[model samples]
Target: MNIARPLLALLVSATLLPDAVAGSFSFGLWGDMPYEKNNDAQTTAAVIRSIDRSDVAFSIFDGDIKDGSSACTDEVFSRTAKTFNAMKAPMVYVPGDNEWTDCHRKNNGGWNNLERLDTLRKLMFADGRSFGRRKLTLEHQDAPFVENTRFHKGGIVFSQVNVAGSNNNRVLDEKECSTKSARSAADCEADNAEYAARNAAVNRWIEESFAQARQRKAKGLVLTLQADPGFDLPETEELDEAKTRGWNRPESGYKDLMDTVIRETRAFDGQVLFVHGDTHVFKLDKPLHAPLDLLPNFTRLQTFGSPNNHWVHVTVNTRRPEVFTVRPVMIKAD
Candidate 1:
């Protein structure tokens, strides 16, 4: 009896021992969900299904809601939004170049690109403030509109800037602009005023959000956008032409915003993950910059879209304060 009792006690001691360790949170990241002729509805459904099946806390679509030339029709926009809304977990969207930047095309609304941008602002960013429900809002009136949107489960800080690929100038066609009467000019002026106000609001939000993150001592930051700041290397002839026409890099305003974020976030002691689309290629590169010189713990992730649609999965663990892992999930269209 004594031997059996002692054995049972030993087993209980081993089983009841505490295994204390920090937990991790997983998130899904996708880019360039072009809801145009190229990306079939069935494929889009499959991607959504995959997201639904996964255990990620949330999903992020980097940008490019449709092809640049696709009409920004209500039906198209609604369908795309509906598909995305089908995901099991909530989704956060960052506008890409194709959504508004290239809406100046003849096939698109043919309206003032800036005005169309306003439409996007109303639709996707309805709150006129935060991204999702993170209580982050723009707080500056300068270049980079400061906005805060965070995923609490992952303990990640999300900041967005309203930077477009075409130098933030979605120029209306000559004929389109000229055809409008004087009355239309008044309307355009009003639209411009509203746009300016929103831009300033976003800038303010960004500054305040960064400051807040620092104050709270956040563990990591995730910055999502459509354009790649580093696109078009060497500034060669091809690069220059592409940049000029909005085919390659984004506008100067976007570049300036990226620089500002990179510079400001460097002060903190945490990982910074830069997620973007626009090039329609899935890439992961560790940009070489002085540690603490730029955004500390910065990792650049660009997921593929359109023909090679894919997604990214990131895991954050507090146990290992030194490193955070980002894993890419490539959902190829079958």
Candidate 2:
């Protein structure tokens, strides 16, 4: 009888062990790179060298591989891809406004934005896999919509959507278009329609990520985008100033996307990390609609970019409740 009791206790202990007690791995996150105003070439090279030296599972460049003021040349995409491939870790990239959305600007060579977007897809992501000597298995949404990508590693689900800054390419006033581009009112009208459709696609992709996370029972979800998605801005006065520009008050563009994201985060059992790069600073904070009051498990990570010229180092551990611990790695911090 005593031997039977000991056998039963052993079975119970074996069944109670937690989900493979999580392992840890680090990865890199950086973007809004090669800005013309900064010490671009020198800084970008240094940042690349630094990442190569570090031990990382993979690296994600959040977007804006070229400066907004530069030409949306095919060469830029190829060159950046080469730089990304040089990293020892796999590289994942999100799309940015400067590369496609704002390519219609006269300074950007007066190119049709959609045409430029097509070029970007062809040159940068045509392979349907990430850049690097070795590639990660990514589930892509595909083709014209190649920017939306998802992958899972170390019990964490990672994804990216093409929500860039510059009001997310939502506004297409003909006058503004005429000033920056030789395109017609008809073309601007088409651009507006494209904006609407893409925004809808982004909204759907945002919701899908959450559903996929739940299905996988992932320990953490990381949704990376290129837009800042303004949060915690000063209310009333300063907010009014910020809101005047569609870029600062993208809630108008992101209302439905944010609504679903917030709803899903509340239902998810693990931590959520919302990452972006347009703001060009290294910021880590709880920017949920109510933070401590609601969605307590969510965190926002804004990567270093432009003048700052640094990258983020994220340590992901399945055993930790937070799932991800992030820190900025300033390659040449002053």
Candidate 3:
């Protein structure tokens, strides 16, 4: 018997298992929280406890383990990892700008932004499995982009890209970079180069994820990341309209990703949900293309952020037309 080949085949087939094979399941979503002020540690602990007590199969943290002004020290990452590992449900965390890209700020310890990003990648995405007691096998991208991953749950394809806020860390001005941190003009140039490289990797990941979903005939696809992506603007249009005036700025790092998303979502025959946490405010809508010209199959869910220290419970069922339903899970105040 060719056990090795059969075993490989079985593992490959598992990724394509149909949603009908399993019943509906729910997961938790949250991010941009637990700042170093306002009694945040207690508040975040309460939020974690609330999640632990929930019946969700897994949880997705969109990003920001700490606030922008805090130090991006190794201790912060280690402590956060410890907390995540303690969770009952498997936790999928995306990197946030506050943790790495904006670490170049003096208040954030004036670290080299790229070095901070590498450190975060090493500490958090140290393996192919998720955090928490339960684990999920994730297919990670190539080196330096391992944080980008694709996993399957309930017949839905889920992708987490290494995209963050702060204009996706594209330093538009050398002067601005120097003023914010102690970086020289060369440092700003290097930062922009880093952004360019990561942006390319992210674009490839987004495209490949959609391709995988289509190949596996997934019921729906959920794209999770940390940036807001500025859906208010007509990201797909070259319009002179008031709603899309600043859509082509150099610092707008999300435009390319947005373009790829609109294209891929239009091509896929499944329900597509874009989840992010930057800019907080707990929003759920179809803000793609434009306000009036929204993508019918696409939906956007922004999880609750700081001070608001709550989470969103998302239920995915292949039998439903929408495929995903979301509700806010509020943590009771002590």
Candidate 4:
């Protein structure tokens, strides 16, 4: 089944509770898993066991299920998903470049990155059950591109967006390269048109997610993605250039999605919490341009991704307004 259709079905059937209370909900958040040396199944399992014992509401795996660039076969991806599913609490995942964009290498199965993405949609988010009884789907109705997944918990709206580090662009595999070369001129043009259509759909989904958050009067917005938005601007010119261009560019689709959420949440007098993992550093630092006055509550929780794959514990208290407190907990090596 198409990803959007299942998502739509789930969303349409989901029950919405306006008076839901966002009491004390705890969840684990982490990123960048299965690195070459540090991320074995045993290590991943131990991390999950720790989270289960922590008594979290749910767990959110930030991204990077594998090294930045590696072959991601069905078996590998499935195993990783299973490991996450094994968490004691419900788990949500945002895509990372490693799982999709960087998986174009021959060793990485050399499959169409888009196709792998579709597979992910089918496996990880095809059904809305992961989010609990209330049905939730991606923001976009026609595409698997989900801007945010929203649910009411303890009277507060908890929302998540699907923004990854890489702009869903990866180097083409040999087959894709060769096929493009052998394709007729008309076929190439047609392919370009399709690409444009998909890109537009993704952009629309992003815009709609923020719009919905505003309409829903969300007390606090939890925006989760894979890449870390550049918090430091005047560091190195090379790094600055990389941040300014390509997928890392601030105004790109992902940034636009976040900016919309940040701006819209301001009108509701809510908090904006951003979570991501790309630099493999576990730290919490507010962005340089966070709108503190409009949205006084803001946090960037990027948990362990490399040396130590850790998870974040977030506590949400839903009173008239909502409060979000985050604590990063590392998975002790056994």
Candidate 5:
């Protein structure tokens, strides 16, 4: 209760504030990797070494720590966790469809995808902390649900969501619900229910993250997801035509998320950085449709994954007019 002791504690806490300690921090992003078992060992080793040497604040592997064709076994999760732990910086990972949603595919061992997902959550996230030898405290949107996490750095709010590609794991149309998977109709129906509820939860979490950013007057907000959401779809898409549903592209399940992103980004007075990895290509641009067409203040960055098997170095600076600068660093495989 002594005044001197309390003042000294306050001074120590102020000095350790995340933003001040993280001024102009950088991070690495990678995903959809370790495919082609023959060469993945070398590639994975090289990429991990690169990240460990990059001297970034931390790294976020957007998703897909393994190939689609691999078995979603306990080994996969544990090995990936070990790989993350090898990084000198803290590592953050979200789920990819390959890890669970699409595990029912015959090529992927035809496991019960839902059960796979449950196991994944338990293995990678049960501790409710980020991966890597160096770990950081994270705020999970829902306790024990590591998919939704929030952290702050350089006055920007950085959040990760478990929204992945393959239509965000949604079961659309009777065809998909009935014959598209190894599971039975009843299993598909149950999956559809999960999709509905989880999608709603993801949308709410996104909105809440934006709200928190605004409340804190963060200079910008960075949202990391595992799906590209296909914002670059052709103008002739049925979804854009109105009065029709677009079944050709992966946009249906992402409409809610896209709407929330557009709405909150528009309302906020600062920049918005959207990062995703599904699609396994590195792309950076502004792509959107009307009413919020091509948001100048919004930037969409797709990270390197799979065959490319690289990582992105992202620098965040809230004091600058441009909130982010992202660069692709292709790891040397030799």
Candidate 6:
């Protein structure tokens, strides 16, 4: 090849680099939808259509393909996978309690929660590529942690960990663990064992993400999962409180993970974004209450969940100190 021609090609490639083109990119986020009682199929489809119409690098379905009350049948996962595969952009999914941990409920077909989780992993995360017509290669942890994924885009490190609600699957008591469905003390014990192993893997993934961010000198980092982590729960349970304060109030399955994130975020020089669902709330705030003062560089984004029929449009701009901006896109009834 001629030297002049080679130099010209290098220049063109440099100009076409993803971050160099605009210094910004966008992604979509949504979860806890298509609830059976809410007739959410049409709305969910509309939201997918809206995402396809927009220009985003990829979309993350944070978790909860169906409502908590729905059965965790094979068809549920298969249908959801098919839907995700049809999207124009890659869809990266995190695990949700409704699909796995809570599958032990009698109404949910009395699935062995861990077994259901294995089925989900094989069905949704069998390969290294993400779901969609335009696939993106992702780095996954070995074996059971295959769903934990990390990728880089627009000069930022992005990761998805399998952390979920239901106290991250740590059953607290006999009543809390065995009252529902076909679960026994043995099953609860097994569940907690699985939780411990996976929790360790999650922590490793977080550390690895931060290390990669530093090595790459990325402008920002994003951690996406499916649990709210109960940052705002009251100290004591009230009569009106329908849900248990699993992650941060009376008990905390997420203490180790939370500690890791806080430490790494504090150490990192760039902005940090934490995105989660499972609370069915739309919120954006700096909600970390540790160290007596909140972390100024850390931001939390909660996507629109069930009965909301909406998706969050997130834009990451390396030029901005905050790095991430979120907007909710409402899906109209079809």
Residue pairs clashing in model 5 are none
lDDT for 140 in candidate 3 is 96
Arrange candidates by TM-score, highest first: which order?
A: 6, 3, 5, 2, 4, 1
Candidate 6 lDDT over 11-97, as tens digits, reads 998778777346798999989988998888888889999999998889998999988887899999899988999999998888888
Number of the top TM-score candidate: 6
- What does candidate 1 score on TM? 0.72
- Cα-lDDT of candidate 5: 0.79
Model 2 stretches astray by more than 4 angstroms:
1-21, 235-251
When sorted by lDDT, best at the front, the candidate numbers are: 6, 3, 2, 5, 4, 1
lDDT of 5 by residue, 107-217 (tens): 788788889878887888867678888897888767434568888777788889888777877776767754645777777787777788788888888898889889888
Q: lDDT: which candidate is best? A: 6
Error of 4 at 139 (Å): 8.0
- Tens-place lDDT per residue, model 2, 30-66, is 8998987575888887888888789887899999988
Runs in model 1 lying further than 4 Å from the true structure: 1-23, 127-151, 170-202, 235-251, 288-296
- Pick by TM-score: 5 or 6, better one: 6
RMSD to the hidden true structure, all candidates = 6.7, 5.5, 7.1, 10.6, 5.7, 4.9
lDDT of 1 at 291: 26
Residue 224 C-alpha lDDT in model 2: 92
What shift in Å separates residue 147 of candidate 6 from its native position after superposition? 0.7
Better of 1 and 6 by TM-score: 6
User: Candidate 3, residues 155-197: lDDT per residue as tens digits?
Assistant: 7899999889888888787577787696778888898898899
TM-score of 5: 0.87
Considering summed lDDT, which 10 consecutive residues are worst modelled in model 1?
139-148
Tell me which of candidates 1 and 2 scores higher on lDDT: 2
lDDT, candidates in the order shown? 0.59, 0.80, 0.86, 0.60, 0.79, 0.87
Report the number of clashing residue pairs per model. Answer: 15, 0, 0, 10, 0, 0
